[model samples]
Target chain A: MIEDKNQQRTNLSELGEFGLIKHLTKNFEINQPSTFKGIGDDAAVLDFKDKKAVISTDLLIEGVHFDLAYMPLKHLGYKSVVVNLSDIYAMNAKPTQITVSVAVSNRFPLEALEELFDGITLAAKEYTIDVIGGDTTSSQKGLIISITAIGEAEESELVYRNGAKSNDLLVVTGDIGSAYMGLQVLEREKQVFQVNPNNQPDLDAYTYIIERQLKPEARKDIRTLLHALEVKPTSMIDISDGLSSEIIHICKQSEVGCNLYEDKLPLDPQLINVCEEFNIDSTTVAINGGEDYELLFTISMDDYDKIKGNPNFTVIGHMTPESEGIHLVTRANTKIPLKARGWNALNG
Target chain B: MIEDKNQQRTNLSELGEFGLIKHLTKNFEINQPSTFKGIGDDAAVLDFKDKKAVISTDLLIEGVHFDLAYMPLKHLGYKSVVVNLSDIYAMNAKPTQITVSVAVSNRFPLEALEELFDGITLAAKEYTIDVIGGDTTSSQKGLIISITAIGEAEESELVYRNGAKSNDLLVVTGDIGSAYMGLQVLEREKQVFQVNPNNQPDLDAYTYIIERQLKPEARKDIRTLLHALEVKPTSMIDISDGLSSEIIHICKQSEVGCNLYEDKLPLDPQLINVCEEFNIDSTTVAINGGEDYELLFTISMDDYDKIKGNPNFTVIGHMTPESEGIHLVTRANTKIPLKARGWNALNG
Candidate 1:
């Protein structure tokens, strides 16, 4: 990815570990008032008076989670931060700080790492979060990234997956299956270009799906929107795994089953067209596709009046008693048991 | 490493991601009072009313940080947790929670992971910290572990490396250089085993140093001891990258010079014996050897009388004006400039 003819290609060893971290993080400025100290210390210090601190972590490996041939290092950096922040947002908390740890082999140039940090800096600035502390080390093979996101919220405002009860209405934000369709389009393009290196395939029509895959954003606005509408979710989770898998988690944890409707799944028109072109089922894509980064929650029926007709939300179904099983009601009125066909890294 | 002849070898795929995490973390219990929720949730939640939160992170890569040929999985897990907690303790804070994220290749069976978790659980129980949140995914090459430790302390009690002033006495807790000598013993034995597979390493004499290398304990008692003595340190850092490197860090950050005495460095008697047997310089081993996990701090001269005769504390150096520059005074009274020969992963 470091193809700049006019730029210098410096090796990482010249800077050393401390010098490299200082060089890359020099531009990051602390913006959060809760952050007492950021970087340049054994640890970062924060003060969240009277509020509970929420912490989440994620690990992303190169060949397993991504392919460098098509996935740019900058986008990978941005998405890594986005994925961790999605977990904090899923708790209905405001993300305040993040720590990023990256391990890279000697194959990567200093400029490549700079590009990756550029994307990370952009995400931190856009999200108004502080880059607190991190560790940089060498890897024997490919790149490995780990991010820990810290947030804060009042104890009473926090939501958990076990809070969902029977008769709660299931709701989801934004559209599904776009990211999966986007991956399909990218894979096809990759195969096409592999056979002929000189080929430049036209991909103007797959713009939406491709962006959904590479530049997915965490739902940072959902918590504010719900608060503004005076509606509180009984339980919530981010759709990192497919809709069916997350629904099953909420159901099993809360001791309640749910009836998910097939017709109510929100899908972008571009995704539907791509699914048809690829000869894939749209329903299957929506249920099993991962990395959407959307929010899925259950709200009590009393708050249904407040959320009804909201463009940001779609009421997919209602929860059932523990005696009933989780089922999907098809457009043809046929009932089928829901299955967790989400992506599994180990299984693959 | 998993050689259970009576038990069936279960592949990681059969449990999937969620099921694997649930099964592995089922035994983890929240023992810290600051922890409100642990595992299961999107993010772990904690409450630290008026105390400032301290957070630190570290990454350990196979072949770069540890060699699996000689390192056991259980010791690796415990050392990983201890390394992060050392950073927290270096800040003069009480570590209360941690999040561990691991990426492993398919070669690792479910039973192997259980052994790793067993070590992590032991650390959590011993340190009285809660195992909060984490992510587990498949890697392409080797195992990688990332841990983030969270702690709390009063704002006034926190110490940074930049706070040292002239005339402060540099004190270190416990002995150093044993771990490095222990590593030399292990590497030698490994080579012997490779040449003759029937050779058994008699490690009776190297027990103390070998334990120090594989199972080093963080200086968790130093803070309590300092509090009891009413001696607040001006600046502090953990000795993970050798004593010379850590001293250089404190001197550079605090804008002061230091005079470290060679004869004052605390070393175990067994370390001296091993150094003589290997024909290596004892002072060089003590200065450049790493992974000691001892606390090196600077305290005011007024507290010297209180800590002078204590066996747990050693005055190895004293801070001087910035114009003097950092130097080491040998036993022969010769002054030489100090150099940081700490291990650099990138260089390797």
Candidate 2:
């Protein structure tokens, strides 16, 4: 079925690296004051009043982490940076700098590289983060992008997975499953096109979903909003692997349990429509869909009033006693134990 | 000729990633005191009392940058790290930590990845550097490694390529051309193996030469040696892309020029022997061979006697006025201009 879309494949060389980076990261916003210089110079610079910093790096390779046949390098670059930034945000730190390392084959002309760089530079500009330094080299085939992101926060502001309390409230920003639906739609269209080259993809209806798959932004705004409200998350993490998987991480690490209501799951009408079209259970998708770069946190009951009515956030669940275990109450009034079907690359 | 060795090719799967990393960096040494951690952490933690930290990264891929059918992975990993570390060292700072990202295809079993990481971890331990964070991803094909090394030294102690002064003495650490000879020997053996797979490689005579190629270490000690003797290099760099190319960097950045005497060029007897056997000019190899991870620096005249008889160093020549240009004196007294024949991947 994938063959149906073979004709739709476009050569990446058409877009230069710089142009691609620019196209992809056009909407990003920088919310951290510590983000001194981002994206253009040889390296991004960050000045910190705090003493400690956390840095992490990741590499995504074509065919392995992605299929360029499906991925646009511009969007790929944006998603890649967002993925790493999620880790920094999860640690309650403000991201300030990033370094990108890319390896391409000679099969690709200079234009393809510039496209990749275009996305990088755009992300740098929008995130107000610097592209401090990176490695550029030749690959035997396909392409590899390695990114390192650095973040800083005061020692007091940093939140760890172990900080969740038994009675704290659990919340997630934005609606979930949209990004996952986006991927499903893209994959379906890809397969559809393979069978018939002239078949135009009915992409207009799936625009939002496809965009979610192609572009995911780090929730830098949540940090600022929470700070302005004078509330700090007892435990925080970005929904990367999936809500269930991340909830389990916090519960396991904090030795607490939680109870979430399926009906309370935030839903974007478009996400629901796509799930209906794809014959996927919306509840399941919302719970288990990964790559939703949204913030998930537990707040003290006293701070609830400050955030409860905010349109940008949803109170998806609340913490339960350890003995209650992490359970989900379905709309049919059935209580089921929560489980993880999160993306675990190593195990797979 | 490259195809002839195909029959004898050792599948990378045999070694695994961890095993390979161990094999390559088994002998590197850590000589700087400022290194807080060297290899084995989320991120290399650094403590520079009063310095502007400098970091640089470089990536190397198989088939494109290196012909692994002849180039060993151990050497590849070692050389890859050296190239990046050399950049940090070139800034006249002490390297303290490094992050390594690798992308490999499934054709390689897990063992091959272990081999690569083994060498990387060993290199970290030897250099007293901590292995911070890195990404391990699957690639479409071949192997790719991107390394980012972080280093720091006092602001006054830091040296840049642009700091070279007119009349400063040019100094080099260790001998050169051996690594190039090593490459020549390996290529020749690869050719021989292609003609006959069963014919064992007679490498007894090329032990030192091959070691130079497969296991070149960054000259971490040079910084300390100079400091201990109360001598600071006005400008410094590690010899990676060959002597001529490096001199050009110093000249262009420092806005100065110099004369290099061919007679004063340091070549070990083993290097001389191989040059004669291969019928390649030894001096040419020294100037253009590349992959010699030694330090080249400029020092003041008053410090000459301090390092004159040190076995680990060589006083090659002196820097002259800008108009003198970069000239290399021949053994027979002919003065000719030096050209940059160092590695340029764009052209390659």
Candidate 3:
């Protein structure tokens, strides 16, 4: 479904390794005070002063992580960076710099790479993070993107996944399940178009969910809001592999059980409607759906008053004793054990 | 030419993502004081205090960067980590942590991955670095490795490639051209084996150069030796892409020209023998052939006494004014303009 535009294609070999890297990263401006030198050298240098540096990396492979049929090159680049930044935010750290390494086959043109860099630059500008250093190389097959994000935070402000107490409240920022439903919509349209090539599917109604899949933003605001309210989370994680999987990670690390209230699970109206239209359960989609770059955290009981009625967060669960086990209380009053059916690439 | 042995093949899907990561990295001990947390977290937290963080990343594709016909999986993993560490050492920094992201097709078994991780863990131990974090996913083709190395150094001790003066002396650690010759030997053996499958090529004489190609070490000792002698380099870079290409980078970035003495270029005895056997010029091999992983740097005239006649280093060139242009002065008293004929992946 991805049409190769019959444009002037410039071979990547015209520009050597150094020339290609320079051409792609020429417009990235260094705005972070922590960054001393960015690109052009053997490595990027950063002076973090007294702040603790946090580093996270993610690898996205073509065919496995994304299909080019529906995913635009620019949005793929933006989402690749966002995915790594979300990990840094999960650590309660402010991302300062990122190094992007991409390997592409010869089928791609110079113009395609330029479009990818355009999206990368846009994300760097929006996040106020400097593009520090990266490697550009040739692949034998499809494209592979590996991004490493570097961030900083004071020792006192840093949160880990092993600090939740038994009575702490579990909270999540923004809505869930939209990104997964968005993927379903796009996939369905792809199959439909495969059978009928001239079909012009109306995608206006799926704009919000599709955007969630294509250009999801890392929760950079939650860190600021928690700081403004003087409430530090006891434990935190990014909902990348779905809410159930992330909850299991937090619980396994913190040595506590949780009771997630199904009725309190936040969902966008569009997502609810899409699930019904597709004959899928909204709760199952919300619990098992992946690629939702939202922040999930647990705060102590004393900090509940500060966040109780806050619109930026929803208290969906509470940590219980380890013996209680992890369960989800259905709206019908039956409690069932939660399962982490998150997307696993290795399973394929 | 790579043979798949009929052995116990454990499918990757049986372990899942987290289980596989944990199984692979369980033996990685956090020995660096700067690494506050390693693995099992959203991001690895590092405390470098006042030291500047030096970051470098490299991407290696299977067929484009390496061939599995002669290169073993374990050696590939070891070389991947060493390559990134070379960049960190080029900046005159001490590497403390590394994140390794690997993408492989389903053909590889768990045992094969364990062998690769064995080499990675060995390099981590030898270099005194912690395996902080990484991402493992499925690839559509052969293996792809992306490694990011993090190091630290004081502001005064850190070196850049743009600090060389007109009168600075260029120095390189260890002999060059061995890795390149090693590849030639392997390729020759591979060709012979392809023609006659049972041809047993004697490789005892090529052990040194073969090891240089298979398991190269970054110049970790060079930083310590310079620190002990109190001689800081004005400019530094690793010799991953041959001496001539690296010299061009230093001269161009430093806004100076270089006159490299052909007779003074270091060469291993084995490399010289192999070059003669192949009927190739040793000097050409040393200048144009790549992947040596040595440290090439420049020092001020005042510090020449500290480095002169040092067995570990060789002073092969001196910097000139920018208008002079980079050149190589041969033993025959002919000056030839230098060209960066480094390895270019996109050329394929």
Candidate 4:
């Protein structure tokens, strides 16, 4: 984190609520043809025509969902959009518009909000989405953000979490556990900085993991890639809460069971090295670590040949009958029952 | 507010996040045919087909938007949904679905949330809306609620705030200033109770005004009535931020000035009586007190004969050329420039 001690502070009340919203959103350009009207209206109008509309929402609160000690306002803004958009991609849809609402205390200045919106505008540009509408208000405590993402897709191309069959192959996109490890690294650095303000710790070795934690990208390209391969997933879900927890969701909703192979869980080399340095089990982190923003889905056994050598995909497991129950097949040929050890915000 | 001193308390972590969501939303039925899939997948699917979709969102924070001492959780839940739906109705659209997301601290028991959801369910039933999806998690401080309402309308029937033309009559639905007076009464009672816990003051006279504050209704019936009368509003907005602020929004966006008559401002009998008791100006409260949830719109002067003596509608003003500027015509035949003095949450 870069701290600027000489930054100028502008009071939010000087501009009022309307002036603040107008100033913050003045640079956001609407590029979606479906968004007939955006901002400046009581409600946004969208003409999805023949396509089906898909909607998802999330609420992120300070101290519970994130800590400002290590999280920059810009990255928090970018990651907030990514997390919501990840759900749209998990459903085989293209996101076209989003509504962003934020509540902050007077401890924040106008420049801080501008930096947050800069990241939002950047994400909207990168993902080709329109910033349709939002509400800005004051919080009695820390900052709170709520986002609602809207997307559209043809009826035939849509996917849900209840279509998996017994013989389907479970697949995961990209690597897992990297984001969780990145958070650990940041936490450690935060502790070090707290003990000694003059100490400047070198973070060159943690660049990748830290970036993964801060700027994790959503798998927006997976839908197009799967479309080109002619492989439509039977059941799909985003890996927001670790691999084992997501597998459980698919199995329970589809009325089937799954056997996940520990050896098949994709892990980046840096994540493995970091886990060793931290003296934590790599397999345990891979199975229970969350915030990967990757797609986890089950496809028909017949489609294995189509994705056999795809670098972006890893065949992690297979589905079984509902009577068998869910289990994890370790590399040592041991079967252990899987449990949902994903991060629980409420438990905190 | 009703307080149960010996109410049973169940820890939220006992059910976990998923179980808590399932238990809370189990009673929400999908009444709209447009909702293809709800609450079980990464996103909810809606088939709008050929009709245009209208979406609006709002964020409510404790201490800033409401006071828990004077507002019950159930009433809070119902009012949260009503505020969002009011925006959709302002566009002359039929609200069909809503997604509610809430963040609360662990101090709130599961039963407290159940009471909140009971209010939400009742509002959903009354408005014929489907609670499609939402996210529930922990907050670090007070409660936070975010809601997004989705509706549908034909292209010709949809309204915006920038469609008002010169010579259009400014019309308001029902009455105003009652909800604000209701809040004043509640606040006074709360203070009185704090000074003497055993004192139980009679509140029979303020029932209507109190209900106006606790459980305001959106204008869902106005659309059907307007359709039956073969009339469409030129421009429309909901009165959440009081009348003066809303009028400024219309005049600035539509590029038309307005002359609001002081004599024609709507005021209920209870609101007048309460204003006298509190020694506050009724006209000032009518124009600057927010959260009324009524519809304000502009209609062509030619349609004046169509709604001349209608009991539900009141014509308070008419639009003029932009050069004339916006003003309030007083009973003394004095023209004073209008200002936006509506409640600013951020300014708090």
lDDT string for model 4 (A1-348, tens) is 444342889999999999999999998899999998999989999999999999999999999888888888888889999999999999999999999999999999999898888888889999999999999999999999999999999999999999999989999999999899999998898888889877787888878888888899999999999999999999999998888889999999999999999999999999999999998888888888899999999999999999999999999999999999999999998998888864442133
Q: Candidate 3 lDDT, tens digit per residue, A138-219?
A: 9999889999999999999999999998989999999999999999999999999899988888988889999999889999
State which docking tier applies to candidate 1.
high
Q: Which residue pairs show backbone clashes in model 4?
A: none
lDDT of 4 at B185: 93
Clashing pairs in 3: none
lDDT, candidate 2, B91-173, per-residue tens: 66767767777777667555455455656766676667756556665577777777777676565777767788888999998
Question: Model 1 captures what fraction of native contacts?
Answer: 0.92
**What is the per-candidate TM-score for chain B?**
0.96, 0.85, 0.96, 0.97
Mark the regions of model 1 whose C-alpha exceeds 4 Å error after superposition. A1-7, A342-348, B1-8, B342-348
Expressed as tens digits, the lDDT of each residue in A1-348 for candidate 1 is 212332768999999888899999998999999999999889999999999999999998998887777777788888889999999999999999999999999988898899889889988987899999999999999889999999999998898898889999999999998988888888887887778767777878988988888889999999999999998899999998889989998998899999999999999999999989988889888888989999999999999999999999999989999779899899999988888873442136
Candidate 4 chain B lowest-lDDT run of ten: B339-348
DockQ of 4: 0.92
Quality class of the docking in candidate 3, CAPRI style? high
Model 4 compared with the native: what TM-score? Answer: 0.98
At residue A211, what lDDT does model 1 achieve?
A: 86
In order, the first chain's TM-score in every candidate is 0.96, 0.85, 0.97, 0.97
Clashes of each: 0, 63, 0, 0
Tens-digit lDDT string for candidate 2 (A256-336): 999888999998899998889888788888888888888888998888899979987788888877888998888997888
